[model samples]
Every structure is written in structure tokens, then in C-alpha cells.
Target: MLETSARLLRLLSLLQTRPEWSGPELAERLDVSVRTVRRDVDKLRGLDYPVEVDLGPTGGYRLGAGAALPPLLLDDEEAVAVAVTLQTAAGSGGVGVAGLGEAAVRALVKLERILPSRLRRRVAAVPVSTVMPLRAMPTVDPTALVAVGAACRDRRVLDLDYTAHDGTVTRRRVEPHHLVSWGRRWYLLAHDLGRDDWRTLRLDRLRPRVGPDGLATGPRFVAREVPGGDPAAYVASKVADVRAAFRCRVRVAAPPDVVRERLWTDQARVDDLGDGTSRLHLAADHVDGAVIMLVGLGLEFVVESPDELGEALRALATRCRKAANGTSGGRVGAPAELG
Candidate 1:
């Protein structure tokens, strides 16, 4: 009876190892006859495991989803991976996924209780003190990310109502390939069926329905290899191509490579002059963020155009001068001019 229980555990582990396994394959792996394999499968079913079977040539058994959750059988590497990911997510403090840190911490505590000592030590060793820069980048809905991710994994076509920057709602039928997170945003790299091309979509702007489009959902598509064979790179390339309302051109006393490291490469176009200096061209929704970023660079730069920017800079300088000399007050300051 003890041996049968052990064998049952071994059988469960084998089933969890893959999506499907043939009866002959399971028998060979378990070193038992096919009849015993069937009986063991039945016993597993009795234990509330959704073990599905198929008959005929090339038939197999599949571990389907049950009504209730079962104890996860994770190997050493899988266990370590989960624990580390949870720790990192909990430590990040809702940076990528909105409001997930608290839930992740709770999940982490529960996970640590069931984890082996070695894995517990590994999770404990993960530093929780890392900090992220305060950027105004939009956070994505964790539920939205998970939903889109599931669709991508199942090769299901997604029907979405998306809001564009202009606030227009458009219906999209997309075969989602992968989810790429960068620049504090989640992007879905998918093939747009209506547009007949590949498109990168921001996850926060989508309202998705699980059902497929009438004809588009006819069959599941195999994930196509994206250009450059990197989904993240593809998303970056697409995001870099976006244009804002206000454009700014400036010349900095630094090399293109140095400037590239300090800014978003895709959003800013950096050109190397034959000299040591480089030119930067970028766009912003308003002059506010641009002014702050350029001043924060700590490098000598000249605004090439836009007299309005020079005026704004001169006003900023006047304010700084006043604050430095204790001259700031309720009254208006002098009209400072910029060359």
C-alpha cells in the first residue's frame, strides 16, 4: 500500500511534467503495464484530479483543470524561480503592475511556508531595499496583463475596444503574440487582423473580450517569430517612433553615446557632430517636462530654436537668481532676456 501511494505520487509528477502524455509512454516511464497505467490514472481521477484520456492511435492523457486547486508539484528550479519572482515583484512596490505589491507580499508569505528550507533561504536572501526612480509613466492593470497573457499563451484571438490618443474608440481583432513591458508600460506585440500588419498596443488602453471575432477566431494561430526575433526590441522600436505635440532641438557638449545613455533612445534622435558635441531632437507633450529634463542633464547646451523656450529659460534663470539672493517675494521680478 505504501509502494502504491509512492507510485501514485510518481505518476502525478509525470503528468505535471508535460501538457499531455500517451498511455504507452506513461507505462514505459513508470515501468508498469498499460493496464496498471489506466488504473493509476483512474485513481488520480478519484482524488479530484482532472485526468482526461483519449483513445485510438496517437491518443493521450491530459491533466485538465479541476474545480478546486491542488497542491503544486514543482521541482527545485521551478520552486526557486517562483519564489524569486514573487520576492522581486513584492519589493518593486507597484512599479510595473498597479497595486500588486501588497497582494504579492501576502502570496510570498504563504509560499514561503510551503517552500523547502533551501528555497526559503533563497527567498530570504533576496534584497528588498532596491528603489525605483519616480517617473510619471502610467502603470498597467495587473488583471489586464494576466488576461492578455493568457490569450497569448492559448493562441486565442483577442477582441478589444481600444482608446487612441485622440480618445476615439476602435474595435481591434488581434492575434496576440507576446507581452512586453518597458518604460513603465506594458505592450502587447500582436498581429492586427483588421490592419493586416503587426502592431504594438499599450495594455492600459484596452478593453478586451474573451470571445473571438466571427471569422478571425476560426483557428488558433501559432506564434509567429517577430522581426529581430525579439519582442521587447520590436516594442521599443515601435514606441520610439511615437511623436509628441511639441518638438525641441538642442545641441549638447557631449557625445551621442553619452546622451543616448541618459535619455530614452527611441524617443530622442541623437546625431553626432564631427566635433565632440552632439545634437538632440525630441518631442514632448508640453515644455514643462522638456525644460526639467534639459536642465537636469548638468551639461552645457544651447537651444537651437524656438524663441519661446529661450524666454522660458530666461524666466527660469531669473527665478533661480532671485531665490539664490533672497530676492524672491510677492512682487514681480525684473524682465531677464536670453540671447
Candidate 2:
């Protein structure tokens, strides 16, 4: 009886491995007779596993979804990967997934308790994950992120409740193409059905409305090729196109590649001047942020436009001078000092 029960468990695991398995294949894998395999299939069905069978040359048994989460089969490597990913997610505080970080932590506790000593060692060996560039990006809703990702995977259309950066929320329908991860943020590259244009929707600001967020029944779409054939490149091109009030270009006394390495690696476009110098063209939403980035480059540079940026730089310089001369109440890098 115990042997039969164990074999049944093994059979369940095998069925869950993939969508379909023929009777002969199952018999061969289990080292049992075809009749026995059929009986076992009946037994699994009796247990309410929803094992569906088609008796034909090309037909086979399939495991359908059940109300409860089915038992998962994982080898040592897969187990370790899940553990490490969960740790990273928890560390990232679920990337603003509400209870996501808490869920990850809870899952980690359960997973670690059941993991074998070898797998536990492997999970412990994985180094901490670090978010790149600026980590100050807003948190993303995990449910919404998964929804858009599923839409991309299934080639479905998504209706979104997207909050624009200007603090206006709008209803939008889009054919999601890809979820591009730029630095610590995720952007969905999609064809806006309403606007009849392509847009990079930030996952953080993406949300749902009433019900039925993704509609598979709607018109199926094959994503058109974006420029440069890359979503990140396309998104960057779009961001660069929206140059605002403060437009400043700087001539840095460094190679284009060197300057690019130092600052605005993504925001600024670098032009090689061919004389150990490069010109950086950048646009910003904030003048102070731009000034801080320019001076933070620690390279000699001349501002080329707006004249407004020059005043911002001068004001920063004055503040620094006062801080250095000990004439001001505050010191240099006071923010860093607060930390």
C-alpha cells in the first residue's frame, strides 16, 4: 500500500512536470504496465486531481489547474534560485509591492525550514543583489507588474489606469510589447491604442480599473519593431525628445566615453570633439538636479545654454564657498552629514 502511494505521488509529480503525457510514456517512465498506468490515472482522478485523458494515437493525459496550489517539483538548483530571488525581493521591499516584501519574507522562512542542508548552504552562498544607477525610483505595484507581463507573454491587450508624472490619472488601452527594466525601474513598451502611438509606461504608475484588466478576446496584436529594435533604446529616444525649459550643453575636458562613464551615462548624449574633449547635451526636469549632476562630474566644464543653468551653478558655487569659508551655518555636503 505504501509503495502504491509513493508511486502515485511520483506519478502526480510527473504529470505536473508538463501538460501532456501518453499512457505508454507514463508506463515506460514508471516501469509499470499500460493497464496499471490507466488504473493509476483513474485513481488520481478519483482523488479529484482533474486528470483529463484523451484515448487516441496523438492524445494523452493532461493535468489541469486545480483550486489549490499544486505541489511543485524542484531540483536542488531550482530550489536555490527561488530562495535567492525571494531574498532579493524581500531586500528590495517588494519593489513597492505593498505586502510583497512581507510575503517574500514569510515565504523565505517557510522555504528555509524545509530546505536540505546542501541547498541551504547554496542559498546562503548567493551574494546580495544590488539595484543599479538611481535606486530612488518609485516602487511598483507587483500585481500590476505581473498583469502587464502576462499581457506581453500572451500577446493580449491591456487597459490601464496609468498615473502620469504630471499627477493626472487616465484610462488607456495598449498592446503591451515588452517589459523593459531600466536601472531599478520597469517600463512597459506598448502601442497606445487610444493615442495611436507608442509609449513607455512606467510600471510604478500603472494600475487597474474595475475588473478584467487584460482582454485576450480583443484584437490580437504582433508588436511592431521599435526603433533600434530595442525597447530601452526606444524609451531613451523618447525621453530625450521631450526637452524642457532648461536645455544645457556642456564641453567637458575629457573624452566622450570618459565623460559618459562619469555622469549622465543614459541621460546625456556624448559627442566626441576629437581633441581630448567631449560635448554633453542634457535636458532635465529640475535645474538644481542638473547643476548637482554637472558639478558632481568633478571635471572642468563650460555651460553653453539657457544662462539660467549658469546662475544655478553660480548659486551652488556661492553656497559651497560659504560652507568652505565657515561663514555659513551649514557645512559642505550637509545632506551627506545628516546621514
Candidate 3:
């Protein structure tokens, strides 16, 4: 009886390793007869596992979706990976999804409870900590995320109502290709049918069109190659264009390569001037923010455009001089008394 049970578990594990398995292949792996494989498959079916049979010349079996989720079998490596990922999600205040942290905690508890002592030790050895930002990030609807993810996987078209930053709402029909998770936000990289262009849309701003049946996903689409053949790079460029309010130029006393290494590729563009200096084009929401970034670079720079940026730099320098001379709180050039 124990041997049969062990074989059944092994069979289930083998089936999960891939989408489909031939009867002869399974028999060879188990060192059992084809008849025994069929009998075991029947037993698994009796236990409510949806084992589907393919009755073609190349006969095979596959696991199908059932009403309820079956217990999953995981190898040692997969078990550790899942435990670590769950720990991260649990620590991260939910990754921009409402109630995700609590859900991750619940799932982690269940997984850890069933984990072997060796695996538990492995999971516990890794520590995870998350520091939340002061600003509130937009949260995505879990249902909408799931619907869009399913559409991406199934190559289906999605009709969505999207809210722009200016509070304008417009309906869009898109063929979603991928979901890109950046920081605490989720973005969809899709081809816009109406505009005849590719668009990176925020998941929070999207409302999937629903019919009486459920999420109204349309016909499957032939997937297109992403712009530049890289989805992440394309999305990053699009996000930078949308978020940057001030495109300020500066001449920095550094080589182009050095400046590029110090700044994020999406945040700044550096061009070599061939005289030990480089031109830096960066985007920021405000001139003060640009001033802070340039000062933090630890290199000498001259603001080239946006006279307001130069004014901000002058203002910052004056404030710093006042603070340094202990005259910021009192009268000009007055030394502060030691407490």
C-alpha cells in the first residue's frame, strides 16, 4: 500500500513537470506496465484530479482545470523559491494591490506549516524587509489585474476605459502583450487598435469592459513583436515621457560615459562634447527637484536652459551659505552661540 501511494505521488509529480505525457513515456519512467499507468490514472481521477486522456495515435494524458485547486507537488528548489517569494510579498505591503500583503501572509503561513524542517530552515535563513515610501502609490484592482493577465496569456483583445492624468476618460481597445511591474506600480504594454500605436498604460487607471458573462475579452490576436524587441525598455521610455514635466539641460564637467553610469538611463540623456565635458538632458517635475539631483551628482555643472533652473541653483547656494555661516536663523553674518 505504501509503495502504491509513493508511486501515485511520483506519477503526479511527473505529470506536473510538463503539460502532457504519453502513456508509454509514463510507464517507462515508473518502470511499470502501460496497464498499471492507466489504473493509476483512474485512481487519480477518482480522487478528483482532472486527468485528461488524449486518444490519438500518440496517446497522452494531461492535467486539466477542475472546480477546485489540487494540492501541488514541488521539488526542493521550487519549494524554497516559492517560500522566499511569499516572504517578500508578505513583507512588501502588497505590491500596489489592495489586501495583497495579508493574502501573502495567509498563504505563507499555510505553506510554512506544511514545509519540512529542512525547507523551513532554508526559508528562515533568508530575511526580507520592506520600507514603504511616504507618498501613497496608486493601488490596482486585483480583478482587473487578473483579467488583463489572462488576456495577455490567451492573446485576446481587451476593451478598457482608461482614465488619463488630466481626469479624461477614454475607451480603448488593445491587444495586451505583457504586464510590467515597476516599483509599486503595474503597467500594461499593449498595442492600441484605435491609435495604431503601442501604449504603456497604468493598471490602476484601467477599467476592463465587462459583459453579462464576465470580463468582455474579444477574439484572440496574433502577437506582435514589441517595439525595439524589448518590452521593458519600451515601457520605460514611454513612462519617462509621460512623467517628466521639466526637461532641463545642463553642461557637466564629466565624461559622457561617467555621467551615464551615475544616472538612470531612463531619467537622463548624456551627450559627449569632446572637451572633458558632457551635456546632460534630464527630466524632473520641478526645478527644485532638478537642483537637488544635480547637486547630488557630486560634479560641477552649469544649467544651460530653463533660466528658472539657474535661479533655483542660485537660491539653493544662498541658503547653503547662510546655513554654513550660522546666519540662517539670525541676522546676516551673525555667529550662532553654542548651546
Candidate 4:
């Protein structure tokens, strides 16, 4: 009886490994009678496993889908990959996905406990999983995020009030399509009703509310493809809109590589001026931030466009001039404290 039970388990494992297997093929592999194979398959079906069967001369049996989660049979490599991925996901904050990560780890531990000694060592050799280091950005309510995500997957439309960078409040109706996560920020790619165009919006900025519940039933919207499928374009566009307020530019006297690496490595567009100098064009709505960036780099640069950058530099130079001359009126030092 015990031997028969073990053979039944091996047969079950084999059936799960493939989509279809003929009665004779399974019987030949298991060295059992074809009648016994049929009996075992019926036993699996009784256990709530959907073992599908075909009749006639080309008769075969296979495993089919069931309502609830079925037991999964994973080979060595497959098992190891699941364990590693779950460990990584635990730290990745996305709505409540962190909880899924935790569950994955617990499940992996259970699987490892039953794994053979060889398999256990292989899974253990994988370094103890650690969360990746990443800057924290804004986080959204998990339930709300999941609800909206479900809508997107179903191709639904949404009505939301989003706070603009200028603090101006506006309500918009949008056809939500895709949710993209870059670095620490989340973006929603949707079509705006009022604007009649596709827009990429910050998920954090959206004041999402329960709406009139509708799908994007008009037409199947195609997602816009950014150049080079660049992941940075969406964030770059957001930054550009904010920077447009301060129309300024600067030329830094340094090699292209050096200037690019130092000042404005992420933001500035560098044009090689040749002869060890590069033109660094910076555009910012707020001069203070731009000024701080340039001065902080401690690089020799010339303000080239908008002239506002030059004006800012002059203002800083004047402050130094006043501080050096204690008379406070372009006169020689006269501070009693300094003397």
C-alpha cells in the first residue's frame, strides 16, 4: 500500500510536469498497468485536482485549472529563483506589495525546509536577501492605489482633482492606462478629457476620489512610446515644466566630460565648445536653486542665455564686496571687531 502511494505521487508529479500524456506512455514510464494509471488519475480528480481526459483511440490525460491555488511542483532552479525574487520584493514599497514579499519569504522558508540536502544548500548559498538602498519619495495609500491599479488593468476612466506645482487646484477627467514607477516616483499615463491629449501625471499629485465608474469604452488607447523607450523622459518633462519659469543659461569653462560629470550631471545639457570649454545651458524657474547648484560645483562657468544667471552672479559678487569693506559703502575695512 505504501509503495502504491509513492508511485501515485510520482505519477502525479509527472502529469503536472507536462500538458498531456497518453495512457500507454504513463503506464510504460511508471511500469504499471494502464488500468492502474486510469485508477490513479481518478484518485487525483477526487482530491479536487482537475485531471482532464480525452477518449477514443488517441486517449490521453492532463492536468487542468482549478478554482483555488493548487500545489506547485518546482524544480531546483525554479525554486531558487522564486526564493530570491521574494526576498527582493519585500523591501520594494509600492502600495501593499511589501506584504506579498513577506509572504513569499515565509513560503520559501517552508519549501527549503522540505527540500533535499543538495537543494537546501543551493538555496542557502544565495546571499541573505537585503533590501536595496533607494531614496524615499511620496507614498500613496495602498488600498486606493490597488483600486486604481485594478481600474487601469480593466481600461477604466477616472475623474480626479490634481494639485499643480503652482498650488492651483483643477479637476480633470482622465482615461487611466498604465502606471509607471521610476526611481522613487510613480506616474500615471492617461488621456486628459479637457485637454484631449495624453498626459503623464505624478501619482502623488493626484487627489483621486471614487467616481462614476466607467471603463475606457470609447476605444482601446495605445500607450505613447517615449524616445529610445527612455524611462527618464517622463520625469525630465515634469522638471522642465517647473524649470521654464526661470529662463537662464550658463557656460562652464571645462572639458565636456568634466562639466557633465561635475555641475548639472543630471540636469544640464552640455555642448562641447571645444578647446577645453563647454557651454552648459541651465534653465530654472527659481534662480536660487540654479545659483546654489552653480556655486556649489565650484567650477568656472559663464552665464550664456536669458542674462538672468549673470545678474544673479553679479548680486552674489556685490554681497562679497560689501562684506569685505567694513565701511559698507565701497570704503576700506573699518570694522572694529576685525581690528
Candidate 5:
């Protein structure tokens, strides 16, 4: 009886490892007859495991979704990975999902209670830390994320009320394409039906329009190719546009491709001037911040905007000179001006 029970567990683990398995393949793996494989599959079915059978020369058995979630089988690596992910998510205040932290803690507790001592030691050895930001991050409504995700998957249209950064609320009908989790914020890449354009919208500022029957999704539409053939890149460009408060155009002494490789997408937009040089457009919240980024590029650059950026650069040069000379005699500058 104990042998049979252990074989049943091995069979379950094997089935969970792959999407489908033939009877002959299972028999070979278990060193049992095909008849015994069929009998064990029947026993799994009797236990409400939803083991589905396909009848034919090329058919195979596969596990299907049951009415309720069954216990999952995980290898050592997978178990450790899941525990670490859960721990990080719990510590991150839910990764933009409202109320997910407490739920993650609960789930982690349950998982830890069932874990073996060896696995517990492995999980404990992992060094995971979450640093809370000075400002609280905007969180998305879990219901909105679910609705938007479903619409994206099913190629359905969604009617939503979106709040713009300027505190303007607008009703938008869009075909949801993808949900992007960039940093702590969630963004939706969708084609706006009303405006006849593609848009990257913040999930936290979005509320799905619901009816008496729950979320009122529009009829499924043919999936359209995302702009630039990449959803993430498109969303990143849009985010850069929104975050650009202090914009500076600089002429760099480097090729466009080289500048692009050196900087992140959100840092600047580089345009080739057909010469050996490249034009870089940089944006940041303050001029000093932009100066710092420009200096870090390690290439010669000429700032061509706002005039304040030039002043900040000169001030930075002065500070660098003062530090190099080790002289405090020159009317100590006003709080470094980098703020």
C-alpha cells in the first residue's frame, strides 16, 4: 500500500512536469505496464485530479483544470524560487496591487509551515531586501488589473475612466493589448478607439467601467500589432515624455548609436545629425539633475537649452575645481545647487 501511494505521488509529479504524456511513455518512466498506467490515471481521476485522456494512436494524457486548485508539486529550485518571490513581493508592499502584501504574507506563512527543514534553510539563506521609497508609490486596483488583463488576453475592448496627470478625468474606450509593470507602476498599452490612436495609460489612474452584470467588455476585436512592434519600448517612450520637466538639447561628440547604448531609454532621445556627432534631448526634474546626467556620459557635450542648464554646468565645474584645489577661500557656494 505504501509503495502504491508513493508511485501515485511520483506519477502526479511526472504529470505536473509536462503538459502531456503518452501511456507508453508513462509506463516506461515508471517501469510499469501500460495497463498499470491506465489504472493509476483512473485512480487520479477518482481523486478529482482532472487527468484527461485522449484516445487515438497519437493521443496522450494531460492534466486539466479541475473545479478547485489542487496541490502543486514543485522541485527544490522551483520551491525556493517561489518562496523568494513571495517574500520579495510581500516586502514590496504588493508590487502595485492594492492589499496584496497581507495576502502574500498569509500565503508565505502557509508555504513555510509545509516546507521541509532543508528547504527552509535554503530559503533562509537567500538575502532579499526591499527598500521603501521616500514617497509612497501609487497602487492599482486589483479588480482593474484583472479586468484590463482579461481584456488584453481576449482581445476585447474596455471602457475606462482615466485620470490624467493634470487632474483631468476622461472616458476612454480602448482595445487593451498589454499590461506593463515598469518599476512600481503598472501601465496599459492599448489602442484608443475614441481618439483613433495608441496610448500608454497608467493603471493606477484607470477605473474599468462596470455594469450590473460585472465588467462590461466590448466584443472581441482582431489583435493589432503594437506600435514600433514592441509594447515595452512604446510605453517607455511615452513615460519619458510624461516625466520630462527640464528638457535640454545637447550636441554630443559621439555617434547616435553609441549614445543610445550608453544611456537608458528614459534618459534621452538621440537623433543622428548625419555627421559624426549626435543630438541628444535630455529631460529631468531640475537643471542640476540634467547636468549631472550629462556629465556622467563621459563625452564632450554642448547644452543648447533653458540657459539654466549652462549655469548649472558652470557651477558644477566651479565646485569640481574647488574640490580639486582644496581651497575654501572662495565665498563658499550656495548649498552646492544640485538640489
Candidate 6:
């Protein structure tokens, strides 16, 4: 009886991993007769597992879809993979899918309880943490998420009411294309009929209404692969008038690799100048962030056009001189900046 239970478990694991397994293949793997394999398959079916048998020269036994979710049988590597993914999602802020992270943790706890000693240690060693910046106090209804997702999937037009970051609200009609999640934020890529252009919408701010039939839904927006699918650059472009107000162009006397590593999210562009130097072009909303970043790079750089940035740095230098002469608060020549 113990041997039968073990074999049944082994068979269950195999079925879950692969789409189909012939009766002879299962018999060979289990070191049992074809009749024994058939019996075991029956036992699995009796436990409410929908094991479908295909009768043909090329046919085999397959684990078919059931009406409800079934208990998954996972192996060592699969278990570890699941545990690690659960830990990550649980910590990726409460934006993408609400309560998903918490549910994952709960499920992981139950799974860990049944894990062997080595597996348990591995799962426990993986740490999870959430760093949600600027809490987006918008609740996304599950029904709206589902409805819009379906529209995007099936190619449908949707009427939506969206509130901008500055609290200005407007109603828009659009053709849904794709949904993008980037660093605790969700954006819906869609074709705007009113403006006749593609626009990205914040999912949290959307009040989606089902549109009538006959309105054409656009063709799928072919996505260009991006590292991590993060649209940070695109979002930053729409930041504020100040972003376009001043452009800070600086040539760093350092290797391109070093400059790339030092450049932060605010930078508009970074290019290798060759000959062990790099050029950085960035929008400066606040002169302080730009000047501080340049100083932080610790590399010699020439400030090109948009002399306002240079003026800001000069003003900061004057302040430092004043502090050196005991004029400003904090230590002398410290520039009154974060170390």
C-alpha cells in the first residue's frame, strides 16, 4: 500500500509536468506493467483528477482541464521557483493585483509547512520586502480590471473617465490595446479616438464604461521589447513643463560604463563619446538634483548649452564660499548638501 501511494505521487508529478504520457511510457518509468499503470491512472481519476485517455496508435493519456482549480503536485525545483516568485510578488507593492502578494504569502506558508527540511530552509532564506513610493491612494475595482482586460484582449473600444495627477478630470473614448505595469504603477496603452493618437492611461485613474458595438477596436499594438518593460523614460517625458524648460548637457571625462552606472532616472540621454568619455543630456526640473548628480559622479565634466544649469552650480559654489567664510549654517565649505 505504501509503495502504491509513492508510485501514485510520482505519477501525479509526471502528469503535472508534461502535457501527455503514453501508458507504456508511464509503465516503463514506474517499473510496473502497463496494466498496473492503467490501474494507477484510474486511481488518480477517482480522486477527481480529469485524466483523459486518447485511443489511437499515436494517442496517449493526458491530464485534462477540470471545472475547478485542483491541488498542484510540485517537485523540488518547481517548489523553490514558486516560493521565490510568491515572495517577490508579495513585496511588489499593492498596485498590480490587489491582495495578490498577501495571498501568495499565505499560500507559501501552507506549502512551506509541508516542505522537506532542505526545501524549507531554502524558502525561509529568501527575503521579501515592499518599497512603495508615493502611495497611490486609488482603489481599482476587480470588475473594472477584468472588463478592461477583456476589452484589450478581445480588441474593443471603451469609454473612460480619467483623473489627471493635478486633479483635473476628463472623459475619454479609446480603443484598448495593452496594459503595462512599471514599478508600482499600471498604464493602459490605448488608441484615443478623440485625439486620434496612442496614449497611455493610468489604470487606477480609469473609470471604464463598456462601449456600444460597431465602434471599431484597433489592431493590436505591437510591443517593442524593453528591458523589464519599464516605460520610465516615456513617463518622465510627460513629467512637467520644467522638464522641457532646461536641458543640462554635460560631457563626462570617464569611461562610458562608469557614466552609465552613475546616471539616474532623471537623465534624458547618455551616450558614449568614445575615447574614455561620455555625454549626458538630462532635463532639470530642479537645478539642485542635476548639479548634485554631476558632483556625485565624481568625474570632470563640461557643461554645454542651457547655461542656467551652470549658473545654478555657480550660485551653489558661491554659497559654499560664504559658508567657508562663516556665513551659512552647517560645516564650512560643505555646500549644505546631502553627503
Query: Which lDDT value does model 1 have at 216?
Result: 25
The per-model lDDT (C-alpha) reads: 0.78, 0.77, 0.84, 0.66, 0.83, 0.71
Residue 311 lDDT, candidate 3, scale 0-100: 81
Q: Write model 3 residue lDDT over 7-53, tens digit each, in one string.
A: 99999999887767999899999999999999999999999999999
Per residue, candidate 6 scores C-alpha lDDT tens digits across 130-197 of 66643344445555676678667556677788988677899998877667654445667776879987
Native-vs-model 3 lDDT? 0.84
TM-score of each: 0.72, 0.67, 0.74, 0.44, 0.65, 0.52
Q: Between candidates 1 and 6, name the one with more favorable TM-score.
A: 1
In model 5, the worst 10-residue window by lDDT is 330-339
Candidates sorted on lDDT, descending: 3, 5, 1, 2, 6, 4
Regarding lDDT, does 1 or 3 come out ahead?
A: 3
Scored against the true structure, residue 287 in model 1 reaches a CA lDDT of 71
Report the backbone clash tally of model 5: 0
Candidate 2: residue pairs that collide: none
Model 1 alpha-carbon miss at residue 270, Å: 7.2
After superposition on all CA atoms, how large is the RMSD of candidate 6? 8.2
lDDT score, candidate 6: 0.71
User: Which candidate's lDDT is highest?
Assistant: 3
Whole-model lDDT for model 5 versus the true structure? 0.83
What are the runs in model 5 whose C-alpha is more than 4 Å off?
1-78, 95-103, 116-126, 129-136, 211-216, 251-280, 292-304, 323-336
**Which predicted model would earn the best TM-score?**
3
Candidate 3 collision pairs:
none
Question: How would you encode candidate 2's per-residue C-alpha lDDT over 1-339 as one tens digit per residue?
Answer: 998998898899898776589988999999999899999989988888878887877789888656666667677888899999999888877754567878999999999999999899989888887454343557777777767776786577777788886889999988889888654567889999999988988788888432343323344578788767878768755655544665678889899767766764345666789999988887766776678778879999998876888888887777668778889766545563201
